[model samples]
Target: MELPTALYLPGDDGGFTATPLTIGPWDVTLQHAGPPAALLLREAERVSGIEGGQTVRLAYDICGPVPVGPVRVRGSVVRPGRRVELVETVLEVGERPLMRLSAWRMRTRADDPAAAVARDAEPHPAPLEPAGSRPEVPAFFTTDVAYHRALEWRFAEGSFNAPGPATAWTRTRSELVAGEPMTPLQHLLVMTDAASGISAALDWNTATFANVDLGVALHRPPRGEWLGMAARTVLGGTGAAQCFAVLFDEAGPIGRSSQSLFVEPRAQA
Candidate 1:
């Protein structure tokens, strides 16, 4: 058999929705790399035709299996208005509904004063290394990129061998999703939610549990694409664990993300 690759989904052709990228427990298919939370928003932005960096608020009522391959995504403004638009995006495999994403966005004013808030706890990002020295197949990600050609990934502090609270970076190998100026919120959607498996490795065994859910709230829109995330574990054990994180780039702190994990014992040797 051939090796797996870090694959990217096609935007215009419904990236990985063309087939069953992966289907496993607490495991996301390769076609769907990031969590459903923020991805739902980003996908909604494109399939639904919302402008980039728009001040958008979106929510998900994830019910059925989020299938992959030749998937069709359709979206529109629910409560269309001059200042803001309520948009929705749906994922389909042929004629079946796999997932639904909804969003709310608004136009803002210039020269607005920034709000006062406590700073993010993550420190300055560590140096980034070359991404070519590791295994090509995705690690821990349920969706094996056996067929897709996605992006390359570089870990800032941790790899599969390194310990907890590491930072990593990824981008399209062939620019499937790029060129559009992204906000910190959008970056958070991709990088911040990748804490579960890595967190478990840093604190305990190699793969102790998987994430139940992850949530992120942006105080302001993102300023650049060089996204950074500092992930650390705050709690664990007894079938539950929590991870805290700080996200940013050269400018300053962007926002934060929290991940909850459901624990299972290490497989008997």
Candidate 2:
């Protein structure tokens, strides 16, 4: 069935409906497909009947563009707990595996339980100033949020024709799903994955990072406000690269993210 163009738009609701797309050698783009995994992991937590706010961590691998072929999603538990749960999913193309995603869901815990006189100093990234408008770049642009509605982005440093890493401040546009309020860690996940590891060069109008395998790990949960991502490529090599990033929620450092990269161009012949 042909998916609606609007359905592909980004947002919390929009993210729930992803249409898999196929391209290149062993590559598939998962469209409007991220946040639903959030809901899915949460559901698994509920079905297990666990208590407390479980921290859900997700990591995905794109074997190929799962978009163009017949795909199926199946998930299972690796380790289950009231505080943490591990699960994995595979997007298979008629028995041939196309992509796999793994996740860890855990309930939130205080960053410091032993401290009494906390040296709590806030590192807020300025109030969200509404930088405005989602991007309309090609699908190859990994950070494009044109498909998302619930989350809007404003780039502190635009990736267009820029070298080095990119920085952006992002926040949620919608209120709490159940009106119970979302935690800082939940906010961190919303913006953590927007920026990829490579930068575009003017010569080819393309930024390619080959052999890209990446993940974001948050040590301290964000405490509301605009979460800032100071992202940059740490190293690169022949057909490959790696990046390191520090995440800030304005109160202090929330956590960090690192990814393996494979740089390439958009208009490849």
Tens-place lDDT per residue, model 1, 134-183, is: 33333444445422223345566765445566665544332223344433
TM-scores, each model vs. reference: 0.62, 0.62
Give one clash count per candidate, in the order shown. Answer: 19, 34
Instruction: Tell me each candidate's RMSD, in Å, in order.
Output: 5.9, 6.6
Minimal lDDT window, size 10, model 2: 17-26
Give the Cα-based TM-score of candidate 1 against the true structure. Answer: 0.62
lDDT of each: 0.50, 0.48
Angstrom error of the Cα, residue 131, model 2: value is 7.7
Could you give candidate 2's per-residue lDDT for residues 1-269 as a string of tens digits? 23222222233422223422112222345433333323333334444434665443556565643353233456677777777777776655567665565667667666564431242554433333335423323334333233334444555564523566666666665432234343455455434544452232222334444333446665544566666676776445455656666777645566677666566554555
